[model samples]
Target chain A: MDKQMLRDTSRRISPYIHNTPIFTSHLLDDMTGAKLFFKCENFQKMGAFKMRGAVNAVLQLTKEERERGVVTHSSGNFAQALSLAAKNLDVPAYIVMPNNAPKVKKDAVVGYGGIITACEPNINAREEAAAKIVAKKGATFVHPSNDLNVILGNATVGMELLNAHPNLDMIVAPVGGGGLIAGTALSSHVFGKNCKVIGGEPLVADDAYRSLESGQIETNYSTNTVADGLRTQLGDINFPIIQQYVDHIIRVEEVEIIQAMKLLWERLKIVIEPSSAVAFAAVLKNKDYFKDKRVGIILSGGNVDLETIRFS
Target chain B: MDKQMLRDTSRRISPYIHNTPIFTSHLLDDMTGAKLFFKCENFQKMGAFKMRGAVNAVLQLTKEERERGVVTHSSGNFAQALSLAAKNLDVPAYIVMPNNAPKVKKDAVVGYGGIITACEPNINAREEAAAKIVAKKGATFVHPSNDLNVILGNATVGMELLNAHPNLDMIVAPVGGGGLIAGTALSSHVFGKNCKVIGGEPLVADDAYRSLESGQIETNYSTNTVADGLRTQLGDINFPIIQQYVDHIIRVEEVEIIQAMKLLWERLKIVIEPSSAVAFAAVLKNKDYFKDKRVGIILSGGNVDLETIRFS
Candidate 1:
């Protein structure tokens, strides 16, 4: 909610998360005509920035709540993050997942000491499964991106980036569930001298872009984007913060996202998921606007299904 | 050749090459039961450690020789490295590649301002083509890894590694044409308090391994290893240095190389070529031998043919 709270959350989760390194590529800088600094969250614990929020949320739990344990429904990085965070803190984590989730995803959660309860592949079913665990086990439910503690935890990303490179003119983050971008915006506003925060969203899943334009939260029915992580819509807890702090949201096509992802792989020599590419894609798409500017880009994650990686 | 020369080379090429960061993974350490430090030369200029040698070699040329320009015969990272290094020094680079070389390789050379001369895909043809360029253009031929200057340049990898983690019990490097390993051995012997230098080679192309035992250079008849970079035989310039200073050579199978490559991609989250994986594979295979020892592994390069990468 404030600078002190974000700093406290950062300190609370410091031991549980990595202050991921920042990488720069001269080739990329030359190609885009912009000075770019990449915050490599792909190297974060559980292979994504989700670990920051997951660890922060778990660490903030009271002794009694921690004993009862935490519950969340995610088949993505958050599941692995929460599982690992709770495991590190000696707290139990109950993860509710859709039955159709990939075996690898299930294995990863189990590998991190999470107890998984499978439900039908639907939002209602997921929420119902999580609620049953909360009710039956007296576990605390933590929303993946809509909780204050989680958002504050994610804010540490921008906090670290700004602390490392304070002269950044703008910071761009992929708008996934509005959590990362909102946190980034808050950090920029509170810590930056004049840094502006921007969001990059999939053109197909342009809920955040539309939400900013309409001054209200919006939903997307068609989530046919290669960036699977950005499919989620904005939440009430983060939307208002985004509206107040976020400068603008840029929507990029699927092709642009894939191209940016490939370039990052080729030039920066780092494995980044399509979601992380969206922010870089946004920067590439609007090179004219970002030209000659010192920009900070959050490489959100690197949790790619290697089997699905086919670069022609 | 010595500590002072290694230090001078580091300082000379400091402006041209990166003092590449060292990365570590608790997962990898736990897997091997050793404290592991990875010197990530994958992030080096031109996507490999070859840049260090190339830049150093070019910088060491006489003023007249530099004016005459430089030349090399290769279709790998060295071609690009020499090209880029020459370009950086404002010298002309004559790169002689096999006509059958990949178009991407050719394009990379041209992209770095090298003038390409294609020849037959054989050692004799490559040598003949390079010799003609030297005779006609008066260019100095810079061997990829067999020249004294290049070996001293490559030594910087070990120099920086020891300077950062001086207490390393052992330093492991992939042995190709022997420049990197020989250089590493010299640095460890001169710079480290008690560091032992080790070489990791492919079992199929185990020339360096055989050379050490036979007390003479040995050629690999079957160079069918997945580690394409390590297929070359040890050269006269580096073989003696390796024999004198390197403690041992560990030959790893192709499957082990691939497994190590995948683990690095999945855990370290960096794109490393199979050649770089060979050193890590060696460590994994001899876990008991290296148990509890502080080991440093040089990740040689990250120049992978993306189309050929299929995990399954």
Candidate 2:
């Protein structure tokens, strides 16, 4: 991406998004044999990195388009971000999710005063339902990732991280649709000294890693990871951006993800969900690479179904 | 507290503390009829305000005391904070907790690599056991609240709040052993603000409030509130400090505290231990007092006995 474009995005979005703290973890450093800085996007607006893109995309909408409102399909953090951002912008938000999506997510959308439309759990079903809502309501469809404004917004996270701790040797973040990592990589390179940006994916769904290696988007996965937030495939727009900016994609096992979750909760004393813990797992799985160096990990979110999250 | 001493403390302790976010609740503001700045000390070190003191106290200890190690009697956040801080300093930490203290608290302290010395529940038995251990082991005793270092550490939090959000018209923090509010009050004044500091207490164990009103310490409670952390009397150092700095004492009924906990958890999307929730409850209870004015409340800690904290 262009440097000026990214810089302008930072200025426009910084006020709307959260400058979440960068925390040092002595235990984390000792565990991985690396000086670890955790960029707590878990503390980001709407409690995740989704707020960056959501606010950016929402704020950039034309006055006429804004009056028509915005639509998206997300069962997790993005829903909350979009709902809250829409609420902030004094515009209507239409969110479509699976009927079986967690009650908490559904309720959060409704609670934030969003119009919720539920479909079947399948991705095709969600897309179809969201498209119907967009058509019927004349609302702008804000893709979960893929969109330029959304990517620009997510890029602000990297700017904040690199600005706060420029000596970061490398960085890791969970990659779902690749919006967060794309923004992180773009912004990290633009603002801070050149540092490797790593994308973490669960072994249960290692599409991004394979896509990265083969230089082609892979749609298939034999999946069932505790990191529900990272279950989606890399977006077309994000893949090209990741190819340009992200250095490597690491596939972490499910058990390691849970172990990371427990470590962050018990040691950091902060609530983090499995997707965010994927970055933790990536650091632990490849501890030797980070040894004695300054490594940064973005803890993307902390929304979890506590009763069902497998800590093992 | 001398000006330079406060400045020195602020500089010494700035690195460890999170300087956690202060979020304004548009939803809660609409509901409560006041502008609220929720100071998330729940994000603080050791998941509470205890870290501010624990780290400073450990840092301020004499070389002789460091050689001797540190000890404290607590069944809550202070235990974990001291354990974490001592671990950071490479000093031995011995916490004397009641045998019936939550397994989670014990697990957290030990998880942070601190040694625990379990004692009987009653204050007399607990103190006797702790004193005996201190005498036998020659460890430096860090009273949970009745210590100068801790009060000063807590004062820094107050200093931060005033510094970050200068327009804060008032401050309300839950009173446990009065360490947090006492320190905050002193720091707020030392930092040169006329901001009013208020103490929030649960009706079940209102010892600190009673002490302030009666003009003397009246120890007459067995700790019957859900806010397990705020059930103790203010310490000797804290008593005089609170009497001097705190502007008002607000009592939130037990039901109000519980209701507030539920509202905060549901709306804020953060799990706050009950004691921290009381400050929020006070702001809600006295909504009329703060209408159209900016108010601050500390979300004390989230290191909770998760199973025990319940809502109707």
Q: Candidates' DockQ values?
A: 0.75, 0.18
Query: RMSD in angstroms, candidate 2?
Result: 4.2
CA lDDT of A69 in candidate 1?
A: 99
Per-residue lDDT tens digits for candidate 1, residues B225-255, read 8898887878998998998999999999999
* Model 1 CA deviation exceeding 4 Å by range: none
The DockQ value obtained for model 2 is: 0.18
lDDT of 2 by residue, B1-312 (tens): 776887788788878777877767677899988788888888787788899899899999888888788999988888889998898888889999899987877888998778998888988987888898789888888988889998888877777777888877888899889899988788767763577888889987888888888998767476898898887777778899889989988998999998898777655656678899899898888888878877888888876654344453
DockQ, computed on Cα atoms, for candidate 1: 0.75
Mind giving the per-residue lDDT tens digits that candidate 2 earns over A166-203? 88888898988889898888887777677889988998
Q: Single out the weakest 10-residue window by summed lDDT for candidate 2 chain B.
A: B303-312
Query: In model 2, what lDDT does residue A168 have?
Result: 85
